[model samples]
Target: MSQEPDRLFAQPLAQVADFVFNEDVARVFPDMIKRSVPGYPTIVENISVLAARFAQPHTTLYDLGCSLGAVTQALRRHVRADGCRVIAVDNSAAMVERCSEYLHSQDSMFQELLPVEVIEADILALAFQPTSLVALNFTLQFIAIERRPELLARIRQALLPGGALILSEKLRFEDAIEDELLTALHLDFKRANGYSELEIAQKRSAIEKVMLPDSLQTHRQRLLDAGFSQVLPWFQCLNFASLIALP
Candidate 1:
């Protein structure tokens, strides 16, 4: 274990960013991300269903911001075995290192399965192949709003004409009543996940300073501006929404 501060849930923006990028997220991530909701199995199942949309035989799957390879693991099981590859990318150095190590150890067991590769690089700058299926799962929210369109365009350029892009996010509802209800329900979820009211309040404040998530309409428009032929919200749970975009 690293001697670093436990910034996963207690630090300010810059400190947490440094810790996330420099320290192994697999070591501290579960305590943070996994605690965002109750019923881990159900959340995993929902994620699995969303990921299955991109799985195909002999295809290259791009997992942008694949923290600790959780989604990658699910994708491997969802996709066909023959010649499939999962290119898991993250800007966090520590996350990349840990994911690479984990994949290497797990590779031999999955010899007949899809190949998983971990890359330490920015999602916006990496070169994506035209044959890849890109998945931005709970990741695009962290990207700056202004850069989303350009990033989407780049992703479209990297994907084949008919390739798919799956994006899941925490969405803001247009209806006031719906928004309030979801917000309360999501908060209840956090509480059920072992967070105290005080902890939840403090964490929300800290997260707002660091994470910049755009509205659902904005995200949809960006995908359209990027030249995707079809873009639609496919699934929703409270504030969470899964969007599918096809090139």
Candidate 2:
């Protein structure tokens, strides 16, 4: 409800640093993500709907890399399974602090909703409980490429039978022409959302070193390698895509 417009990259920068989720980013994340990620609203909203379908009674729902608690709130809003609790985790202290505040706001406005626990910790370091739903929305791409397989395997191991892990990411294409087209279209999407040329250039430079996307085929295969029986892609807007992997 209290989303500040992103102006972090509005000014000219002599050298853009790799992006980090700090207090400044926590303040403007809602605006930045919505404007930057195409169909982000649809993905988050439908994540909740899909979460409702996968949520099992008495199981915990995990929202990994839950910056500002967007997916966390969605899961709380739609999940009706009995005794279900939401655990939102982020490595950034600033993000977890604000996410807790936002979830508290949602709590005041709702009734009999699932309880939420906001944890400030790295997802890979923490021990997981059997979870019914795990939302990894745009979080995995920031992780080190070499460590992704173990991370997915960990998620798969933690998931209960009939549970799922919903992963949303900016995708990369192996095809040269397809990659070029989608990249241009994504830049246009940012332009349409009011990001200026300077802002776009600066932001892209900042995230390029940190955010590394994989191809859709790689994602599906990775999920299978992690022991998930199915990797169902439910949404794809421009270069962004969301997949539901079942264990």
Among these predictions, the greatest TM-score belongs to 2
lDDT of each prediction vs. the true structure? 0.72, 0.94
**Over 4 Å off, model 1:** 1-25, 37-58
- Cα miss at 93, model 2 (Å)? 0.8
Return model 1's CA RMSD, one decimal.
3.8
Find the 10 residues in a row with the least total lDDT in model 1. 11-20
Query: For residues 139-189, could you state the per-residue lDDT of candidate 1 as single tens digits?
Result: 888887778788889888877655688887887777789778888999998
Model 2 residue runs over 4 Å out of place are none
Model 1 gets an lDDT of: 0.72
Which pairs of residues collide in candidate 1?
Answer: 130-160
Determine the backbone clash count of candidate 2.
Answer: 0
TM-score of each: 0.83, 0.99
